[model samples]
Target: MGKYIQQTDMDAYRFYLASMEKSLATIEKYLRDINGFCSFAGGRTITKELVIAYKEKLIARYAVASVNSMLAAINGFLSFAGYGCCRVRQVRTQRRAYCHANTQLTKSEYLRLVDAAAKTGDERLNLILQSICATGMRVSELAFLTVDALWAGRAEVCLKGKTRTVLIPGKLQKRLKQYIKRHKIESGPIFVTANGKAVNRSNIWKAMKRLCAAANVEPGKVYPHNLRRLFARTFYHIKKDIAKLADVLGHSRIETTRIYIMETGEEHVRIVSKLGLVA
Candidate 1:
């Protein structure tokens, strides 16, 4: 009924997101989702029913979590465009206590991934894996791993308009120093391409994928974010402190941290076995 999402409306929504200090990734995704909905609507009058129809189309093609993310982007854009009532309800699903087996990266597998990189004489990749796993930092924070941070034995990572401190382990600091010396890196991000720019996520992702075969780890479990989860699980195993771990992982919500340290299904089965309820 009201005018379809106009170019001026989209431009205003982008400015609104920037005013709220939304992360670049979030802003891009929201705008992309809004554009996709616009394409689907094809100048038709926008309504709640049309939104519901688009949601159904999404459900047929994507997982519930993915659909919810797209819906969230749509809702954010709608509210920004002064059509808040056009927002659709998110799909309801039970919370998962454990991640899928295919997604979980065991400590042994992680070590093998490191070894695989080293075996191929890829020093940078090896250190990248160790840096992320040891510090529980997001891949985007990799840019903060600079020569100065190495000397300081900690990195001040600023992400999503919030800054957090990530401590470098003594052994890891030593290794990084060696890497800096070997590469003759004077003062900049430790990980850089031949052109000396900070290594981007896509390059790191593809490099990690190449190690999957030699590491004997599943391809799905080899991304940079999984390394952070590995660190969270290991820290919780040793200290059993969820609250402190949440701080170290830069999460404002402990519930979000809980997702990182969920036990494996095998471990859950072992715990259930201890109950001895079955004959």
Candidate 2:
């Protein structure tokens, strides 16, 4: 039988991921999933059967998307460790046609969140929320929202070996300029902490969460990424151009952009009913 997986292998895997230039968050999540599989293994020698069993357990407990993500991590680690024979296949599920309404952040809810931030004297959080929703940029891309970009009315965002230009809406540009001047921010990223470093994803997430109660918005629907989704949906509604939207959102595939603009099941039903096919 083959030998059991060891801590040394996990350590080496971390080094490999770093060398590959994986983001810190990506490395942490991959390692965390690998560790979970290790715990399930219980020191047993890795085998295809054991890996499949773990995959089944994950399927029973998590959403299909989540199960696939964990399996991807495990398969990646197994391949890196030269144990590719033990990797299990991921579960295949049909694509969803509509997004869950409960998780969707409406524009009204977003406005309320901004209002809540303003009432609480969190000027930075208010602007941060607007910046993301207005630009369709990722939360991680917030660092690229610099003073220079605001002046230029566009930002050049580079991530994952790809770069795209994000245009700043005229209204949003005016507002951000006022914020920069009021805050006395001379140069560099307009959104920064007291130490002048760009605010990271975790900090922005927590700050946004604190506004849920005051905003009367569901906590589940409030997050930085949702702001980006709101942007995509709004842009698609206005322009009705999926290809251009895909380019604006920096998506290599229009299929991905479609997910961002999917209507809720209720909205889908409403539109279908208006077709008046029934007597």
Candidate 3:
């Protein structure tokens, strides 16, 4: 005996999220999650029982993290819509001490990816991969790598209502300058299509996937975010400072940065075995 959430209420919820300064990506994800729940409920009123049932359905189809993320969106919507009592519990996930081998892109593999891009004469692809790794910037933040930022030796990345300065290494600055001169890019984002629009995440992802075979790297390890993670690991290896790494990566939480530098299972075992407990 409950009432279905109205379209007007959904629109208002979207406006509320925007007012809270949620990033475009986050807002879209929240809306998508809420829409998914609405579809599942099929115009019925959302209740605790209904939400619990939906959680069970999601458990069968998605991973724990994804399910929790979806639940977060639903909970946010419920709070906004005066249905807090109906909010469902998120699935608890075990902490991961190590990442799977297939997803962990090694430094050697990263070099191979760059070499492969160069061999193919796809200069943009090559530089894009290098830029993310060198700067340790997220793929989405590449839009900030404009000619002006290059000249200044730092990119001003604004996302999720926060702005941060991402420095460009001196060597990378020289290369980027040369690339700009070679391409005759007067101003604006260096990475863009012929139409002058900044390349989107999906395009960048597909471009990296295309390089895997030529690079002789596993396809699973060739995504753009992995390049950022590679940067995190490399920086941590050299500096061994987690706080500094978090600041560089623009992460509010050091724990989030730790995830980026999490070792693979093989590396974890090697370190654990060195404890000398097996005398």
Best by lDDT: 2
- Return the lDDT, model 1, position 58: 95
lDDT string, candidate 2, 199-259, tens digits: 9999999999999999999999998999999999999999999999999999999989989
Best by TM-score: 2
Give the per-residue lDDT digits (tens) of candidate 3, residues 102-204: 9889989999999999999999989998999999999889999999999999999997789999999999989888998999998999999989999988889
In terms of lDDT, which candidate is stronger, 1 or 2?
2
Residue pairs with backbone atoms closer than 3 Å in model 1 (clashes) = none
Tens digits of per-residue lDDT for model 1, 142-254: 99999999999999998667999999999999999999999899998999999999998889999999999999888988999999999999999999999999999999999
Positional deviation of residue 173's Cα in model 3 after best superposition, in angstroms:
0.8
TM per model?
0.93, 0.95, 0.93
TM-score, cand. 1 vs. native: 0.93
The TM-score between candidate 2 and the true structure equals: 0.95
lDDT of 2 at 109: 99
